[model samples]
Target: MGKLYVVGIGPGGLEHMTAKAKEAIEKSEVIVGYTKYIDFIEPLIKDKEIVSTGMKGEVERCEKALEIAKEKVVSIVSTGDAGIYGMAGLILEMKKDEEVEIIPGITASSSAASVLGSPLMHDNCNISLSDLMTPYELIKKRVELASEGDFVISLYNPRSHGRPHYLRECIDIIKKYRKGNTPVGVVKNALRDGQEISLFTLENFDDSIVDMFSIVIVGNSGSYIKDGKFVTPRGYSL
Candidate 1:
């Protein structure tokens, strides 16, 4: 039987690609991913066959990769950590008769949080604002609950075409349970080229600045900005 490596390529840069991930890609005869992600690794994979897909075609892409892997060694690539809102879940769901190996990489949330200090040091939850598969009401409910529980939130897929208002709604919901002065940080294309970081308060979150590539971190009431970095004290060193 052929082997399959489900690899995470990190956020964007070639430097971020883990050695194991690169080795897996090099050993594989087929590399599969979204077009944007595939483009990021194009230079590394010169002789391999690339199978890429458009947006919202994750399942189809994975299925195609699996079919090809049955005959040839294949590597399915995802940006950031494969387990966190990445291709890990889909690949697992699609794997029935095949044995797959997952090679992990840095998650965007982790990278973003590291750059902005430590907003996730305390109790925190990661939420995705994209409602393509989930209903808006459900997303709102999750945000509301997380806010009421005083959990810092790391939001993914915060903004995109035809879904510009979701992030604003998330901010509004969190504001109702938390203070208007709560710290919020936006990290765009974290750890990648043209990376940008923006800090603001819950009351002043700039909706105009967010995009699909951005990750928005909303801190709890205990969170604060120190020297331009947003931090939530973990109480470990207190």
Candidate 2:
């Protein structure tokens, strides 16, 4: 009669995690997550049974957690908010009448937004460039629509060695609706070791520096950079 807790650890650091997420992990006798995400919370679960898998093993990891939760309190972790591109949905989808609790934490988009100032103050949409689970054509369409709507856009899984040009292609699609001067914020390893934040314009953005560890925010038409801070005006009279 053990329960499952799906937890979001947040931005590769303990400080970024929520109290409920921490408590869930502490209460679990078995912890599960991707290899790197597991590393982020290694100190907390050192004494607990850890189950980790590398990339593309998400289904396997979730299945393992379901099995273990039958006998032990199990906590499966995701890097960002569990519901946002995290493990919570998958676990819920695969379970049958199992008691499950979702513990949310800061998502990468919000973490990156905070580091870059306030690019997300206005209407925004998050779109992942990775086509592994989604088709590239659909992803491109979403990017185009987000740009057309003038919503601040956050791009996740922007680039990697396997798909080096995906980010560039997405930028080109965004260019169709956004001006070259629109502000863009790129954050690498946000709130984590070796964090880097850069502010630039859509036309001059250096996509070469972006990788899997990066999150890119493309501002709406009204967004701007002032005093080295990237911000989107919420239309409030000041």
Candidate number achieving the greatest TM-score relative to the actual structure: 2
Model 2 per-residue lDDT tens digits across residues 49-127? 9899998899999999999898889999999898999999899899986789999989999999998999999999999
**Top-lDDT candidate index:** 2
Report how far off residue 125 is in candidate 2 (Å).
0.6
Candidate 2, position 41, lDDT: 93
Instruction: Give the per-residue lDDT digits (tens) of candidate 1, residues 124-185.
Output: 88888888878989999999999999999999999988898888888888988888888999
Q: What is candidate 2's local distance difference test score? A: 0.92
Question: Clashes in model 2: which pairs?
Answer: none
Model 1 segments more than 4 A misplaced: none
lDDT of 1 at 233: 88
What C-alpha lDDT do the candidate models reach, one value each? 0.90, 0.92
